[model samples]
Target: MDPVTSGILVVIVLLVLMAIGTPIAFALGAVSLGALVLDQGMGELTFFGETFFGHVSSFGFVAIPMFILMGAAVASSPTGRDLYRSLDIWMGRLPGGLAISNIAACSIFAALSGSSPATSAAIGKLGIPEMRKRGYPDGVAAGCIAAGGTLGILIPPSVTMIVYGISTETSIGRLFIAGALPGLMLAGLFMVWTLLACKLAGGYNSPNPVAQAAAQIKENVEGNVKALIRVLPFLLVVLGILFALYGGVATPSEAAGVGAFLCLALAIVVYRMWQTKPIANIMRDALRESVMIMLIIATAEIFAFALSSLFITQTVAGAIADMEVNRWVLMGVINIFLLVAGFFLPPVAVIVMAAPILLPIIVAADFDPYWFAVILTINLEIGLITPPVGLNLFIIKGIAPDIALRDILVGSLPYALCMILGIVLLCFFPEIALWLPDLIMGTGS
Candidate 1:
């Protein structure tokens, strides 16, 4: 068989495996190995080691653990609860008051933790009960937490943005800066949905005002502010990491290593939670996650290499070019494809699989890949909150099982629609994404 035909069959087989419940990393590795053997003979398998070494050995990926540890520190420490209470007080007066607070808290927590599940788990723990007590529907509460927590992936210092940058060879700093606007934009969209849903459902039910019980809420808010003040050292540690990288004082990988140590020291000073118990546990956990991701990346890279070597890029690109659709129309089409596929797959895999295929068309149509990337990330963020395999939804469900899956999924509809709208707005006007990156990185350097 021709390389193109074999490559196409390889991908189809991989998707079949994935649809049949095979793990993503395994599915990718299996097809990748198959492609190498069938198209180029087992002799070429040597390239897998080189590919693995080149991509996985990078220091930037260290941010995955650093950010994860920071999340764990905040999760296990006293500070995490306060962040939620603070956001709750500030945004809780609105319709779906606690739901609004969920969005606000996720963004704030994203700033602190920079990981979606961390924000989801932290806020979901606090936010879910608060909303439940306030007479909010269980599904709405769970849905808000699930959707809001995805903020971690898009905000600055976001592990997803960092990973995307490393994998795509785009500037990590630029991707970080680029993500700022769209990340916040998506957050804003969620806020709007929370408000509107709560507003529309205003007539559904009424509860005795919990205004009196708010004494504890107010106290919690104040405590959160105080915790923020104490956590300033940790904040400084993170800020210094980002500032060093963005200001060109350090490369991203170096900053990641430095950032990890700085965060550990800050946790020690402020919380004094550092002992052999947590330290050993944190390292072990970090190492485990790191090893898993590194292995997946290694295998995925080999898979990507074989597929591309078979002209998958040009073939897919040519197919799209032959469609001869207007560039904007094509953007819409790719985005819709992503949103639909997102319902079934993890967001990262969706991006990895599609980016190589899509970038060529994006370039041929004169659309900026960076802009497309931000737009693509937003669409994937929706997937994280959407039904079926939506990752964040399950995170909340695990935390609060009394909440029916249908409610969480149904409550997510408005927010998901808002996300779609956000994507459309961004597609029509690229500046929403490009503006901040342009200011920070200065014209594609």
Candidate 2:
């Protein structure tokens, strides 16, 4: 069979496996291996062990667990709660203030922890009940967290970027820097949508008219100052990491290590919950989370290797490049395909499976790969809020079980549209993603 035909069959089989509830890692590795064995017999199987082990054996990949540890450690502490409370007191006066604050907290937490589910769970646990208590609509409250959570990977120090970089041999550092402006841009878009949604929906519901009036009046006097003081340390740590990485003072791994240690130390000192057992438990959670991700990554390596050896990836890219369609139209079509695929797979799986096939086509069309990364990341962001496999939707459901999954999904639609707008913005102004990396790292692609 032609490589294109074989590649198409492999994808169909992989999707069937996923639809039938196979784990992504397993489906990916299984389909790849099946193709290999069919093409060249069991002797070709020896490549699997080396590829799987070697892919995970990178110093660059070290940043993934380190960043996850940092996030888990912070989540185990009071930082998330404190950050929310701080933003809440200040942002809580706006239309849908609590919801706005939820997005703000998620963005900040995204900076602190580069994992979407962690961002959602940590902020959702704090934001949801409070919003519900404030009479914010359940769907609105849940949706905001669900949407905001997607920022975790678009922000710097992102684990998704790490995996993409490792897979594509893109400079991880530049990818990290490239994400900053776009991440902030998406966060801004979410906030705008929240404000507009709440306004149209009759705004935030206050618990007590008299108390709210009194609190707002007091907030006029001293709240901002107090909130600033309360949040400064946490903000400083997040800023310090960004400054280190963006300033070229540290590699991503070193930066992650520093951020993890610093955040852990801050968590202990400020929360003052440095008991032996609690600390041990915090580390244990981080280890558990890290191990789970590492396993998926290890198996994904097998899939990546099989795709490369079979030339399926390059063949698909070449075919797409050879198409007579306008390049921008092709980009749009490719994005649509990604959006559909994202409904069934997690962000990591989408990137691992598609980047190899689509990236070269993107480059061939003269789209900046760095800029394309931002656009692709936005697609992944939408995936996090999308249904069936929308990781953030399920995350919010897990955190706020009473909020129906349908409500969360419905609420996320606007924000998902906002993310689509962000993608359009990147498509028009690739410089939004390129400028920061070029300024900081001096451009290479």
Candidate 3:
């Protein structure tokens, strides 16, 4: 069969399996296995074990579970509440301050957790109710949390970036640094829109009387101090890990190990979670999520191998390359494809399956792979809040069951636009994404 026919059949079978409730890992594995058997006959099954194991046996992949454990530790504790409280105390008086605080909290938590759903669930649990209490519109309240959570994949220690780096042989450190600036830019955009939205909605809260404000500040002084102290250790750990990674003090796996240990220790000491149940819950959550992601990575490797064996990878890349299209136009098409893929697949799956195929095309177009990583991430971020499989949107709904799904979707739309604007700005000023990585790591090329 022609590569095009085979590619379509593979996609159709995979999608049908997924639509009928097959797990992504299984569907990917099944399609790849079937394709290989058909293309190469039964002899291929003899080496399937080796091929599958080889895909996930990388030492760098260890960073995934360790980072996930770090996130799980932080998520299982009261750290999210403390971070929100700290930001709230400082920013809560500004117009739409509560919502802004939520976005800030999400950005910080995104750095800590490196998982969007965890960031959303942790911050949303506290921020959503608090925003609702403060007379913030439900749409604004839900929108900020949902949108802010997408920052997880764009920030350092990001599992998605790790997967992309591993898939494409890009430097993980450069990928992390590449995302730092763009992530902050996107967060700033979220905050800017939030401030404007609140103002346009006649403000989320009325101004407090001078005397009442002073009294409220005095009352919360001790608690705020305690909250800041509680939140400081986690921030320090995250910063330390980033420094280790960027400063060449440790490999990604090594930094992740130390970060995971420190985060778990802090969780135990600060939250008094020494009990078996809490500790076990953290491990269980980390293990479950880690296994899910690793399985997808392994299966995606198989899928990619199948595509290569079928000549689809080369065929498609050659077809696109032969078009001689404008680089930006090619990028626009790639972004659309990624956005659609992301609507159904998680970030890791999309990165592992698509990055290998896209990276060469992007580099052939004279684009920096690291910068494109940020762009690809922002595209996927939009999908996290989009429909059918918008994980963050569902997380918001679960957090605030009474909030209409329509309201959550409506609220998240503006933030999605903010991400698109972020992409546009990055395109016009590639330095926005490239400058940091270049400054620190000296141009990844």
Per-residue lDDT of 227-248 in model 2, one digit per residue for the tens?
4465577668778877886677
After superposition, the stretches of candidate 1 with alpha carbons farther than 4 Å from their true spots are: 2-8, 203-210, 213-221
Each prediction's number of clashing residue pairs: 0, 0, 0
lDDT of each: 0.74, 0.82, 0.92
lDDT of each residue in 237-287, candidate 3, tens digit only: 999998998899999999999999999999999989979999999999999
Global Cα lDDT for candidate 1? 0.74
Best by lDDT: 3
Of candidate 2, the 10-residue stretch with the lowest lDDT total is 205-214
Evaluation by TM-score, superior candidate among 1 and 3: 3
Model 3 TM-score (2 dp):
0.97
lDDT, residue 2, candidate 3? 99
